[model samples]
Target: MTKPRVLLADDHRMVAEGLKSLLAEEFELAGIVEDGLALVKAARELNPDAIVADISMPNLTGIDALVQLKRDNPQVRVVFLTMHRNPAYARRALQIGALGFVLKHSAPAELVLAVRAALEGRTFIAPDLAAEVFRTPAKKEAGPAEALTSRQREILQLLAQGHSAKQIGAALNLSARTVEDHKYRLMETLGIENNAELIHFAIKHGLAP
Candidate 1:
């Protein structure tokens, strides 16, 4: 029998290496990407049966990347592997169509189980987070920060990470002027006036760590 195709996305080189080993036996490795933007591109090209991604990633977050991917391939399964224990993140992942939300600290077996559940069209949350995922009610309205477009949020994260417009542009394949424009618009939307304030806003709103 053919193994399921899996795409892996995470910024940490060591973590990606570890997952590659663990997943090798159970799934056909489609490709591995270091950031969310690359993950989206790779997923589109590879058309994997499922994706395992980290929530906090550069260029675009896993959730945002998955959002874009779902627009074109809604049947693709995604299981988020995140370091965040925050129930809010888990709830958001599920709400955005992720079938699994496993914590980074979870046992390796749990990730395998999560992947299997996702492939079978079932939902899986880390045992510790399962209760919280269910206990949380659906959000009726988008949060102020959530109102930002995916591109805006990506630029905001780079800004919060202290990347200059030129660096951010190079990273995302946008022009420096475009990066600057996005920064300005994000700042205006959030009512922030400067880089310091923008960084603070991103942290407070969980746009960046």
Candidate 2:
């Protein structure tokens, strides 16, 4: 029988390698990428059966990448593996269509199982978080970060990561002036007065890795 094909995405070399090893016996490793942007690209090119990804990755976050990927291919199956133990994060991830949310600390024992579950069209939340994630109200008011457009969120993350307007423009294919305009507009939308506060908001809201 053929093993299910899986793509791995994590910025940490050691962690990615360990996951690769962990999943190798039961799944075919379609590809591995170190950033969310690459994860999006690889998933498009490779069309793996499932993706194991980190939520906090460079260039684009796993959630943001998923939003974009889903627009193009809604059937894509993603299982997030991350250090974030927050129930809110898991709730948002599942709400956004992730099939699994496994924490990094529990990955050795749960990741393969999560992948298997996702491949079988089942949802899997880390046992430690499942109750809390499900108990949380699904219709809570949107947070400041949640109100931002996906592009704005991307720009916010890049800004918090210390990328200048020019660099961000280069990465996002916008003009530097446009990037600056976006910064100001997003700051205003979030009621932030300066770059420092913007960064603080981004970090506080899990928009920045």
Candidate 3:
């Protein structure tokens, strides 16, 4: 019988190594990836049966990565491995079509079981997160800092911290006009009437310093 194949994605090298050690015995490790995009690329190329991902990875978050990878291959299952014990994120992950979420603090044995369950077409949320999601609601869908794409969130955060448009442009390798356009669009999306409101909103949302 062929073992299940999986791709590992996480930013922490030691964590990845530890997981690889635990999984290699029961699974055929396909390839290891360090970022969400690489995980997506590997998933499309390797077409592995499963993916175990860390949620806070760079370039793309694990949830965003799952969204993209499932777009590419709906049949492949994903299990999020995170240190977060937040019921909200766990439920959101399920709502977003993830098959399972394994808490990093979960026993190593549970990780193995989570993988097996996912491979067998079963959903496996962590035992501790078995509560109704109390996810924050009523936040504006488009915040003042949301004009930037996933890649631009960090940049916008800096801008909110009082960086000049030229400084932001230089730092991001974008033209000043481009940064201004982003600012304009961000304000429009958030329905802010002026730069003062924009800055206020950004600061309130912790996007600004």
Give the root-mean-square deviation of each candidate in angstroms.
2.1, 1.5, 5.5
Ranking the candidates on lDDT from highest down gives 2, 1, 3
Model 2 lDDT at residue 38: 87
Per-residue CA lDDT of model 2 for 1-209, tens digit only, reads: 99999999999989889989999899999988998778888999999999999999988899999998898788889999999998888988988899999998884878888999999999999998899999947576777777899899889999999999999999888999999999999978988898899989988988888
* Alpha-carbon local distance difference test for all models: 0.89, 0.90, 0.77
lDDT for model 3, please: 0.77
Stretch of 10 with least lDDT, candidate 1: 136-145
lDDT of 1: 0.89
> By how many angstroms RMSD does model 2 differ from the true structure?
1.5
| Decreasing TM-score order of the candidates | 2, 1, 3
Pairs in clash, predicted candidate 2: none
In model 1, the Cα lDDT at residue 37 comes to 79
For model 3, how does the per-residue alpha-carbon lDDT over 7-101 read when each residue is reduced to its tens digit? Answer: 89998989999999999889999889997668888898998989999887754568767877767777879999998786766876887788889
TM-score winner between 2 and 3, please give it.
2
Taking all chains together, each candidate's TM-score versus the true structure is: 0.90, 0.94, 0.72
Query: Top TM-score: which candidate number?
Result: 2
TM-score of 1: 0.90
